[model samples]
Target: MPRQACKKGSHACDGVVRRNAEPIAYAHGFDWRPAYNCKQWFAEHSEQMTSDRGGMMKRYARPLRLLAITALSVFLGETLVMLLLPFLEPLPQHVKVLLDASLVTALVLPMLYYFLFRPMALYIGERDRTQKSLSKLSSAVEQTADAVVITGMDGVIEYVNPAFESYTGYTQVEALGQTPRILKSGKHNSQFYEALWKTILAGGVFRGELINKKKNGELFHAEHTITPLKDDSGSITHFVSVWKDITERRRAEEALQTFSQRVMDAQEAERRHIARELHDEMGQALTALSISLQTAEETAESPAAAEQLHQCLGFVERLLQQVRSLSLDLRPSMLDDLGLASALRWYVDSQGQRAGFIPQMELDSLKTRLPPELETAFFRIAQEAVTNVVRHAHARQVRVQLHRREQEMEMVISDDGCGFDAQGLQTRNARETSAGLLGMRERVLLLGGQIAIDSAPGRGTEIRVRVPVE
Candidate 1:
C-alpha cells in the first residue's frame, strides 16, 4: 500500500487511517474506504449537521436553565418538609421519610414535563406525520399508471416505481445502478439528447415525446417529463423522469389521418367526374338548344312568334351560362390544362366582377406544375374562402398571394371585410361554419399542410396556408 507521511491529528489526515491508491479510514479500528467522493462530502455535511444541532441546543438554553430550577425545587421541597416535620412529630419515622420523598417528587414533576416530556411528545407527533406523508407519496408513485424514474446527479438510476418495471420490462434488480441510456431506442439523434441534458442540467424542466426500448426489444412512444430535484442549498441532486406511454394513441392518430386522406381523394375524384359530365353532356345540349331557338326565331312566319322565340333563345343562353359557371365552380378544366395559377386568375377575376370587390392577385409563375390533387385542393379551399367573403364578409377589397418556395407552397388571402368571430366559428361543434371551414381543414390536412385563419369581430380576416411540395 502507498502511504503519505502525515500526523494523525492534522487536517490533511485527521480521519484517514491509511493513504493507499484508495484512501482508507478506520471504523472502531477496522479499515474502510468511503464510496467515491462520499468521504469528503459526508465530512462537510456531518459538520454542518452537528453545527445545526449545536445551534438548536443554544436556542433552547431555557430548558437547561429549567433543569437547575428542577434540582432547586427538590431542595426547596426537602427544606419545607423539614420545617413541617416538627408539626407532624407524632408521625412514624418511616412515614415521615415517605412524606418527604412524595413532596420532592411532586415539586419536580411539572419542571420535568416542561423541560423534557413535552418536547419529546411534540417530536414524536411530528415524526409520525412525516412518516405518513412519505408513505402516501411512495404508494402513489408505486400505484400510478405513468412510469417514474429517479436518477442520481451522475445519471445512474437510483429508483424506479412499479409502473417503470411494467412499462420497460426491466426488473428493479436489472435496472438499478444502470444509466438511462439502457432505454435508448436510437430513434433520436445526438442533438436531441444534448438539448435534453442542457435543459435539465440548467435546472429547467424538460417535457417532450420520446421513443424508448423495453428489455424485450419493443419500442414504445412516451410523453416524458424530466424535473431536477434540489437540496436545501439549491444545488441539483437528482433528476426525476416521468413517462407516460402514448404508442397506441399515436398509432390511432396515424390511422385516422390515413383514412381522412383517402376520403378526401375519393371526394375529389367524385367532384371531377361530376364536373366533366356537366361540362361535356349538359353544356353541349344547352348550346344546341340555344342555336335551335335562334334558328327558329330567324325563320319564323309571324313577327310575334319570332319575338317569342327570341325571348326563349335569350332564356336558354342565360341557362347555358349558369350551367357552365356551375361546372367551373365544381372543378375547372383550366386547372388541369394551364395549372393552378391560370385557374385562380380566372376565378378571382370573375368573382371580383360579380361580387363588386377589387381583387388583388400576386401569383407565382410555377414553371413546373404541382400535383393534380394539390392543385385541386388549394383551388377548392380558395373557392370556399372567397365564397364566404362574398356571402358574409361584404368586403370592398380582397388580396390573394401565392408563392412557390424551395420546399413548400405558401398562400395568403385577406379581405378588408366585416369579420366574424374566427375563433368561435372554428370551435363551435354545431353546423354554424363547420361545413366550409371543416372542408378546408380536411383538404389541407390531406395534403400534409397547415392553415391559419386570423380574424376577430369587426376586424378584417386573413387566411394563410402552407403545404409541402415534396
Candidate 2:
C-alpha cells in the first residue's frame, strides 16, 4: 500500500496519496500513479475494487477472490518449478526438459480454469436467473382468483398456488403430494372420473362441471378445464387444470328456471279454474233454459211447432253436456277436494261410463297422508294416463293400483287395450296421441317422481309412478 499527506488546513487534500504517474482529482484528494491509469490496474481489473457497497458484495466478492487466488497460484507454481530445475538439475536433456515443462504449464493451467471454475460460474448465473423467473411466476399465480393446479400424470398434486389455498382452505404444505380426489364431493361416481381420465389420456381436452368439497366440508361448484401436458414425444406427462368457482352463478340460473316454471304453472292453473267455472255455472244454466223452453212448447196446441221445439231442446241439451265435459277435462274439481286415490278412482269411473271401459281398482294399504301438491300431481298424472288409455287403447278392462311402501307412494295403471310400442313412442315426436303421455310425465317430474311405461303392440299398457314420501 502507498500513502501520502494532504496540504495543511485543506480538507479536500487531507490524507491522500500521490505516486509517479499523473495526478487526478478524486473526492478526497489528488493521486498520481500508473496503476490508476492502466486499464488492467486494481480498480479496472479487480471486481472487488469496483464493486458496489451493498448486500451484493457479500455474494460476489468471495467467488472473484477465489478466482484471483487460483490464477496467482498457477503462475507462481510454474515459475518456481522452472527456476528450481535450472539451479539443481544439470541433466543431459535439459533443453527438452524445459520445453516439456513449458508445454505442460500452458495446457494444464488453462484447462483447469476452463473446465472447473468457469463451468461453476456459469451454472450459478443460470440458476439465479431461473430462481428469479420462478419467483415472479409464482407471485402472479398466487394473486389470481382462478384456481390453478399442477398435477403429475398419476393425478397427484405437485403444486398449488396461494389462490388455491384461499379457495379450498388448504395450505400448500397440507395438500402437496396429495391426490386431487381430496376435493371430491362424492356427487359423481367412479364412472365419471374413469371417463374423464380416459379422454385426457387419449390426448383430448376435458371440460366439465365438478361439485367439490372444501376442507371444512362445504360444497362448492366449479367449471373446470383440464388440459393434458404432453412431452416432446406427445406422451402426457402431467395435467394442468384451471377452474373457476361458479356456485353462485349456477344457483342464480336455477332460480331463474324455477321462476319461469312457476309462471307457466300458474297460468295453467288459472285456465283450469276458468274452465271449471264455465262448466259448472254457465253450462247448468243453459241446460235449465233448454228444458223450460221444451216444457212450454209441449203445452202448446200446434203439433208441428212442438216437434220443432223438441228438436231444438234436444240439440241444446246435448250442447250443454258437451260444454260441461270440456270444462271438466280442462280442470278437475275432484282433485282438489279428494285425495289422490279418490280422485283417481273418480276419473277411472267417469272414463268407464263415457268410454264404456270399466276400470278395476286395487288400492290397498295407503294409510300415509301425502302433501297436497304431491297428491294433486299424482292425481293429474293418473287422470291423464287413464284418458290416454281410453282415447287410444280401446281396451275393455283397465286396472288402477295405489299402494304405499315404507318411504314411498306408488301408483300403477294398466289397461288391456290396443297398446302401441312403448319404446317407439318414447323416441317419436309428440302427436295428439302422445300429448297425454307428455303431460303425465311433466306432472310426475314436477313432483320429483319417476314414471315408467310398459307397452307393446298387442300387449297392454302399464304405467308405474313412484314418489318419495319424504
Best by TM-score: 1
Give Cα-based local distance difference scores for all models. Answer: 0.85, 0.75
lDDT: which candidate is best?
Answer: 1
At residue 417, candidate 1 shows an lDDT of 95
Instruction: Name the lDDT of candidate 1.
Output: 0.85
Clashing pairs in 2: none
Candidate 1 — which pairs collide?
none
Q: What's each prediction's TM-score? A: 0.78, 0.52
lDDT of 1 by residue, 404-448 (tens): 898999999999999888888867776666588888887888778
Give the residue spans of candidate 2 off by over 4 A.
1-174, 179-211, 214-218, 222-253, 425-433
